[model samples]
Target: MRFKIGIIFIFLCQIAQAQQSEMTVNQNHYDSEFKANSELISEFENNGKSNAEFRLIAKSNDNGKISVYIQNNTSDTISLSHQDYSIYILQEAMNKNGLWKPIEYWESSDCGNSFGEIKIEPNEIIQTKSTKYSGNFKTKIRFKLSENNKVYYSNSIVGNINPNKLILPNDFSFTWPLAIMENIGKKTPLELQKKVVFLEPNGMEEFNEFFEKSMNKKN
Candidate 1:
């Protein structure tokens, strides 16, 4: 009877451990998305020029509008010197053969509108409405500095775009380098290191194919 009880306890412990692991994964994904958004907001506030730090807070409304909040954490006021900002929504796609393809990029400006910029005071938050895009996808918000369009600071919030639909898979099994090796002819060592950390070794072909398709389109 003691041996049977021990086995039961072990099985329960295993189940608890598995549950904890799944929870940790979910929390990590949430934290990653939050951090990405925060980084983008900081870039916009500082315009890649100021040393002050900022953060982003993204909240989804029931009416399908995403409200992005920009806050200044420092004691001094931070100014976002941009006239207009833009938000891009990327949808995940699957090929006919049941393989996960590259992300489909859609811009809010393409829909004939854009988000305006606002000044964020110290210890204050400014909110802006986000444009809607189709499918279960992630949000990448960018704030462009008025001085030079090419030197824009960007941040991506990783979450499901379609709140009504099922959650999208968050597996990092795809390798982007193999798919775009021809495009990245002379990559820097730092770029190579980032690729190694982000992409899976065996999924290069799949990553490249999806990237090619996505880039070729106007959306």
Candidate 2:
């Protein structure tokens, strides 16, 4: 009986030590990478004949301010229609069980008329604040584009903040302009466009098969 009691005490000591070590490791990981409960999301695009590109990046500062970047990637004149553009941000929080929950949303448009119908010449990028809307972060970020009040393109970006890394949950996808043109009778030759890249959850092999069948059916 004495031997068994001694062995049980030793085993309990070992378990306690292991638990302490695990807690230390978790704390160290959090200290190195985790931000104080904040996240950002943004999107942008270029509408030019050539390979023009635009990007919108968002960052959450320590003081609860969100900064936005509108970057242009071409050396030619680029005209931006502010009426056709908008920016949105969503904030989220983690619960005690580590599940992410939506907190709020923010949006901006026109910049109080101080910026309107803006035009950025080739190679010029603009950075501005979204003064039109402000709220807490929500669960998703959506960017939309339109012409004459009709939506021409839209994209959705989803991610969650983990320690010091922003893990992108999936690949970003853009609607093909050819599909839009076809809807408007813009002379889009369906036969010339042979491949369609579907960014859905389905695998690439399935997407390719579907594309082939759709084209065959149309023909």
Candidate 3:
């Protein structure tokens, strides 16, 4: 009995060590990839102005991932935002104000300190990491990429908001910001929040109505 128990203990220890070794290998690979992608983004930031033939193509994969493919037509390498975080604006349809208002409140927590970017080699086409859309309205929505205060718009894609459908990791529920809550009918400025949250269509309407009613009573 003693010999059998000792063998079992040794086997368990070996299994634990094997799992730890695998985890270390995976972590190293992730760090390597992250460093590689960051370096590409830096190169573009430094020399992107000299290139003018770059193009941004938006694509939605079957996995509900929105990927922006950047085609570098210049002879030099260039970098651009990965479009995987809150780097792009979610614009609603053309309203009576003739302005495309940003209605997206989703922000990524995975990106810390700086948004992710990737370097595309000369004539190389690279796609960004997957990004999820959270707009609950059934309007024509588009992604807008801005650099140097100039906006670059993507092709419009329309879909209804599915609160049950989780398109992002670690999504939560939170109250709308005062900027959006106060300016219910008006166009709100493009402000990025810290965490991404999903709300049902009716939930948004109910909250907005409550906010408006409370404000009217105060007035």
* Model 2 misplaced stretches (Cα beyond 4 Å): 1-52, 83-115, 131-219
State the lDDT of candidate 2 residue by residue for 1-219, as single tens digits.
999999999999987554322211101000112222222212233333434255445444344333344444567665544422332222333433556432222112223553345455554445433211222322333322222222222132343322211222121122233443343222323322211221112333444465566667678
lDDT of each: 0.38, 0.34, 0.44
As a TM-score, model 3 comes out at 0.39
Report lDDT (Cα) of residue 20, candidate 3: 27
Considering only N, C-alpha and C atoms within 3 Å, which residue pairs clash in candidate 2?
33-164, 76-122, 90-137, 90-138, 91-137, 91-138, 104-136, 104-137
Q: Decide which is better by TM-score, 1 or 3.
A: 3
**lDDT of model 1, residue 102:** 24
Which candidate should be chosen as best, given lDDT against the real structure? 3
Report the lDDT tens digits of candidate 3 across residue range 1-219.
999999999999987554322211000001112222555455445444533456554555587666554456688876655333334333334333545544443332333454576566786655554344433445454555544334456556654433322222231222344454454422221221121122122433454565577577668
In lDDT terms, how accurate is model 2? 0.34
Residue 71 in candidate 1 has what lDDT? 54
* TM-scores for the candidates: 0.30, 0.28, 0.39
| Full candidate order by TM-score, most accurate first | 3, 1, 2
